[model samples]
Structures are given as C-alpha cells and as structure tokens.
Target: MDVTYPSSLALALFSITLVLALFVRSLRSKKTKGQLPPGPKGWPIIGNLFQMVMNRPTHEWFHRVMADMQTEIACFRFARVHVVVVTSSEIAREVLREKDEALANRAEAYSIDLISHGYHGISFSAYGEGWKLSKKVMVTKLMSPTTLNNTLVSRTMEADNIVTYIFNLCQSGSMKKPINVRDATLTYSHAVMMRMMFGQRHFDEPAEDGGLGPKEKEHMDAIYRALDCLFGFSVADYLPFLRGWNIEGEEEEVRGAVDIINKCNDPMIRERMHLWREKGGKEKEEDWLDIVITLKDDQGMPLLTFEEIRAFCKDVNVATIDNTMNNVEWTIAEMLNHPDILKKALDELDTIVGKDRLVQESDLCKLNYIKACSRETFRLHPPNAFLPPHGAREDTTLAGYFIPKGSQILVSRPGLGRNRKMWSEPDAYKPERHLDDYSRDSMGVSMLEPDMRFVIFSTGRRGCPGTKIGATMIIMLLARLLQGFDWSLPPGASQVELVANNSNLFMAKPLLASAKPRLAPGLYPKIQV
Candidate 1:
C-alpha cells in the first residue's frame, strides 16, 4: 500500500520543520555569539520577513525603524539570515575599509543572479578567483588611463552631439522650446556608453531629433526595467522555496528584462567573438567589446567565457547610465531653483572655457566649482537608497556587535549624506560646503570621497573601478550644458520643484527648462551620426 500526503499537509509539514530548524539554530547562535545589534524583536521563525514584504519601499522602512530606535546601526533578520544596515560613516569605514577582506563578497539574491547570468560578472559575482580575474581585466584593459585616452574622440563626439541637439531644440519653435533635461542627459550618456562599448552610437538608424531611436528606446527601457527590479526587496530572495511560485512576480519580471537585454547584447558579442576566433579580425582594438573579447590567459586562450563577456557587457550598460544621468538632472534642477548657484557655475564655465569653444575633458581638472556642484548633487541626491550590500564571508565583530557569517552589510547612501553629525544643515543643497581653500592648479576635484563622507564611487576591495570615467562623464556632461546654453525655468514656472520620487530618489518630475544658445553658432559642432 502506498501512502501519500495532500499539498496543504505537505506545506504544513515543511513550515513546521523550517520553524523547528530555525529554533534550534537560534538557540545555538545564542550560546556562541555575544549579542546582535539593536532592533525590534521579530517573530520566532519568520523574523521580520512579513514586515519586509509588506513594506512598499523597504529602504524607507529600514530608515524609519532605525530612526525610531535612535541607532545608526540596526539588525533585522529574514528567515535564517541577518541583515545589518549601517548609516554611520565610522561603521561604514569599519565594514568597507577595516574589514574589507572579510566583507568583500556580494550577497546571493535571485534577481542579481538572473541579471548577472549566474555570477559571471564582477559586480555581482562571489568573492573568489573569478571575481579577481574580472576586476583585473576591467581595470587593466577597459577603464585604464590608456584606454580612456584612446577613447577620447568617442566621448568628445557625443558631447558635441548633445550641444548640437539642444541647440536645434532651442531653434525649432516660434520661441525656444523648453528642453527636457532628463532626456537630453540620458541620451548623451547612452550615446557615449554605446560608442565605447559597441563602437557605434545607435543600434539602428539614429534618431531624427538626436534623441533615442526606436531600437535604442526599447533597449534603454528594458535596462531601466532591469535596474528597477535589481536589489529590490523580493520575498523569494529570502525564502528560497517560494522562488518558482512567482510570488510578487519579481522572478518573471527579471527573466523578461534579462531576456530583452540578452537579445540586444548577445548577438553583437557572438558576432565579435566569431570575428576574433574564426576570422582573425580586429588587429587593433577599437571598442570595449574588443578589449573584453580578445583578452587571453597565460596559456593564450580566451580569458573570459562567452557568458562572461555578455555578462560584463550587460553590467557596464546598467552601471554607467542611471547614476550619471540622474545626478546631472538633479544638479541642473537644483541650480535652476537657486539662480545664484546657476550663475556661479556659468561664470566658472565662461572663465575656464570661453564661449568660443565647448568644455573638454582636459578642462575638468580645473573646474573646481562645477565639480563641487556635481559632488553636492551626489551627496544630496544619490541615485539609490543603498549601496549593494556587502556580505560577510565569516562571522565577525563590528562596532561591538556580533555579526554572523553571511550577514549582509548595507550602507545607506542618503543616510551618510544627510547625517546631521557629519554636515551642517545636512538637508540643504550647499555646493559651497564641498569647496575647499586650495588653488585651482594644485587642487583637483574628484567624485570620490575617501573618508566615507558620502559614496559617489564606493571605495575598498570590491569598490567601483570606473571612477575616472564616471567622473569625466559627469563633469563633462554638466560643463557642456552650462557652457552651450543659458538655462532658465520654463515660462510660467516660478521655481523648480525639488520633490523626489516616492519609490526611488529620481526627481518626481523630469525637469523642464528653457535654453538659448549662449555661444557662437559655429561653436556648436554639426551633428554627426
């Protein structure tokens, strides 16, 4: 005779077994560890999982809980894992700098795993030889000073194109049309990254209005979709058994976004791989794809697998666009609201780069006030709520609290910037605060703040490798816009409203501003496809 259990009975049995296992583990943890960080006591088995799931935007919830508790560090458990959130720079330094080696690993999550193609890329890959190899390639080949210098033409071309695009917008209507700061900035960023990655601006024909083309629009939409889902609070991430159940529909969304991204990227990658391996093409590297595809191991074999190349390409696309675009948009909006700041930035541009020419990458070194404006935006309006959580590889002690192995260390981006302890009137947009008493020639401004005052590009073993490129892109984008046109609040709008999106830190509304060409007509380069 065969004995079978009903579905409900099986679920009930599984739940009971899970709770008992957790109870046993908790008792063992209590015996071994000193004490966890301060936080609200969660239910026995679930351990704040419900609260996390119910929270619409989990970062706000975490911030509120920590605020109410009056603590900079807080721990909340989800199932068997401990999630520690850090708001203090001292503790942030402790996690990212002092104990960097132990906390270099990234947390394992369903969404990131899917987007990264099973940890093939550096950003989401587990800490090990594979991650080391990927980073080495990224730093040495793709983002090296040599490569950046070589690719200067591509970046410069896109910068000129944006000026031309905006000039056309200014000239198109009965009066000058209001510029969509967000769209123009996004296009400029997208075009630059595409030129560096694929050696082309548009996947298909270029947009008639110097905006995103049909294929490019679809591709960017998918990329933003993927980003929206990435690192989101998906219930299935903590409860592995519920993964395929499609609870909250996150899995399906990620899969669909990844599919769209792969569809756009994989074909180009495969075609290039064939050219290198089969046809012996590309004697000189022209783009980042060539650098990645042609890299070889000591044995003279391709260093990265096909999946690794694809994953790296996808990682570059996602990482480069959003933060740079958002920061520029926010900076412009803030400047429009505070005309004094706007005038100061324009004056600096006029002094450094006269109206006869556009701002170049070389000018970035001396543009201290402009760089400070960008830094201020980074501090006040970070694109994300938290840096990707760094997972602890072994049990460790941090700030006198017992941290278990595999505990996720989440550093709050907004928290560090807005901490009253760190800044005077932290909530206000004060670019002057970042300005220092250093000469222009001797003092070069950078997006990185090594003291952990606020993270533009994170620092440490697993930190971002693209800081130079990121800073150049950000400053150049801002400089060109400021030098090329006179920006003002659109007619009938008294001031730019600085409200943030409920779900994310993006401006609640895309900034609309009026622009008039401030430079000679010949200064704006003719649009080139």
Candidate 2:
C-alpha cells in the first residue's frame, strides 16, 4: 500500500505548487493592491499560523512584529483567516468608536461557543438585540451600583481576612522571609469575588471533607484552562478545511474544561433556585446568584436560562478576580522595584489614611496617589496585552485601509500603553501624570471609558461589565496593603521582573517580596467579624 515518489520529484512538485500558489496570490493581490495593510508574507496553506502558534504567546510576539513593520495597523493571513492588528490609540478609537457597530462581534472560537452555551453569554455573543438584552441585564441588574453597594460589607470582610492572614504570618515570625504576594493576592481577590457572587467565602478555606475548598481550586484551574484554550491559536479554527482533524487536541480539552465548569456551577444555580422557591420568592436577593435566579426579563420570563446563568457566573468570577489580582500584584511589584515610588505611596497613605486603622473602601476616594499608582500599573501591564478578538460585521474601512467582512481585528493594548507618540517617556513608571488631572474623576472618567488611552477593560459596547467592581477591588486591596505594611524586595533582590515571560498572559513572574508590619501592634489584630 506504500507508494513513494523520488526525492527529486517530491521537491520539484513542492516547488511547482508553491509557485502556483504565489501566482494565484498575486492575481488576488492585484485586485486589492494598495487597499490591504502591509504585513508579513506567509506560506501558501499555513500562512502565519506557524509564526503565531509557534511563538509562546501571540500578543507579545505580535507587538514585536508590529514594531518591526513600523506600521500602526498590520494585516496578515493566518491560515485562511484575515487578521488586522491596530497598534495606535488613534486606530483603536476608529475601530472601537467610529466603526464599533460594524466591528462589534468577537471572532468565533469553538471553545468560547461551548462555554457560552452557543453564544448565549454577553462576552462572545454577536451584536444584536439578544446581545443588548444580555448586556443590559448584566450591567443594570447584576452589577449596578446598588448591587455593588450591597456587597461592600462582604468585600471589606474579605479584605480584612487578607490582613488577618498576613498579621498571623508576621506573628509567627515570617516577616523577614519573602512571602508569595501573588498567591496572597489570588486568595484575597477570589475570596472577595466569591463572597459577592455566592454570599460565601468559605471556599478559600481548608475543610475536613475537603469541602468547597477543593472544588473552588478545581473551578479556578478549569477557568484558567478554558481561557488558555479559548484564546490559544488553533489551525482548524482558521483553516476551515481542517475542522475535522483536531490538529492540536483543542476540541477535547475545551469540552472537558466546559464540563468541569458546568459540573461545578450547575448545582450552585439549582440551590439558589430551590432556595428562592422554598421561600415563596420572598428571600432577600443576597448575592448575584440569588438575583439571577429570581429576576425576570422584559418578556416576564427568567432573565437567564440555567445554562446562561452558569456561563454568566463563570464570566463574572474570572473577569473580576483575574484582573484585580494581577493589577494588585503588578502594582505592588512596581512599588517594590522603585523605592521612591513606594515611599510616595506610603507617604500618601500616612497623610490621608493615617496608620490608626486599616484602609476602608470608603477611603479609596481620598487616596488619590494610591489610585494613580494602580492606574499606572494598569497602563504598564494590562490584563491582556491585546484586546479580545473582534470580528467585522461587514466590509469596513479602518484607518484608510479596507477590511473585508468577518476579518478578525485585534487592538494592541500593550502598544497603546507604551505608545511613544502618545506618552512622553512611555516606558518609564511615573504615576504623577495621572495625578495632574483629578477633574477627569468628577466627569466619571476611568480606564473603562473610551477617552482613556488605556483599553484594558476594552471599549465600546462589549466593554467589561464588571468594571466598577474590578476597579474597586484593585484600589481597595492596594490601599490596604500599602497602609498596613512596608513592603520591599527580599534582601539583595533589587528589581522586580517587568518583562512578561512566555508562560502567562499578563504577569511574567511570581512576585516574591518581604512584608513588615507598619501599623501599631494593636492595629495588626484581626477584625472580629
């Protein structure tokens, strides 16, 4: 059954095929000459798939490529898919503002489709009435100011728990040794988010039967895995001819991740529903889960189906925790790396917050410098180096370049943050720039708003719904840590790692830093709550 060609014959065939492919490509190129943006010329069938997938993380790689290309917008083909990356804030504005309606839909990803119950969730849903309805419910009902105000006490309690844990560590004579700041932030952020979402924080604790604790860890892992797979480059997705092949085993992995998430979330949704019914629908909506189970839509039907509710819950948790945790960790690492900056933050805390009591969420407004530092951190290390993939709804023109329908558009968040033309001394860590103008604060200006150059939370219609909660969590955690302790790199370790490594999406390395109590002895005592 084995039929083989001679080596010379095989080589000649490949050469002829390549020539033909190039000839065909030239014919197509002639029609769109000077229309498409400039980019790398890739091979016949694979295009830039090898360059994209072979690289550790495409975001960082793309940034470097963009720099080399010296163009704000670069276009290339990855397999059969057309990709457009926008680097400058000006182009980002055009894509997210001027042409938002035409570019509102996210690129289709098999993994996200499964997790979102066939695009039922708001994040990946196409731009239409269904998306508007879902987004309205999420913003107006689930994460409105009222809901956030109601959950303030629980969030504070979680913050207190973090302080208590650190206090205990100091008490046990672990102050001189470096602590895993990343792990601590993860625990704190997850606890805060869980309490707000599910009305409990016990998931972060150890249990005899290995109760919700183990399940919580598993759920977090599954969420991360799902994100990685959903965003990870896959050949089948781009090249339709290969859909059945499962070249990277992504299909199976995505299914397993979705199953894990659903298995953990389904029961929680059921319990919330059962409780609502058992109380004759009179149970006070204590948390997000309760609200979703009881709230009705415009049609007088349930706001979300069982599947949609679980998907929404997963989205909220992952969105809120991941960004808040990373922002806090990065902000702290930045301060540790710069003693002058750290001193300024500590001085601000002492002057405004004082050392008498722990920093409260209420104090966030008064801690202007601390807020600036956090914003600076976000500018430097956004939650994602690139905006979530967006798909063109129809043929559109972007920055004077033609973009065909369904082309995937990515806004380079990293490039925007470090844009030399926009920001002076762009690579330097200076929080003072933000402090220069507090008037923007009164206008409700924030990183989430379109006017801000930094688009970590994204822009336009599909912006993150958890923006307020995320901002609050980061500000509060940073304020508390700065107020409660004096932090520094472990002795002799001078600088914190700034360059993101290949492994993670946001953070490059784990933050290892020493913490010493700055508060009075009595103030270090755990809150009685």
The global C-alpha lDDT for each of the candidates, from Candidate 1 onward, is 0.85, 0.74
lDDT of 1 by residue, 137-184 (tens): 899899888999999999999999999999988888744568999999
TM-score of every prediction relative to native: 0.94, 0.88
Candidate 1 lDDT score at position 194: 93
How far off is residue 255 in model 2, in Å?
Answer: 3.6
Which is the leading candidate under TM-score?
1
TM-score of model number 1? 0.94
Look at candidate 1 and tell me the lDDT of residue 215: 80
Candidate 1's error at 120, in angstroms?
1.1
Deviation of model 2 at 262, angstroms: 2.6
Query: 137-225, model 2: which lDDT tens digit per residue?
Result: 78988889998899988988878777767766666755688877877787787677777888876543553321236777677667766
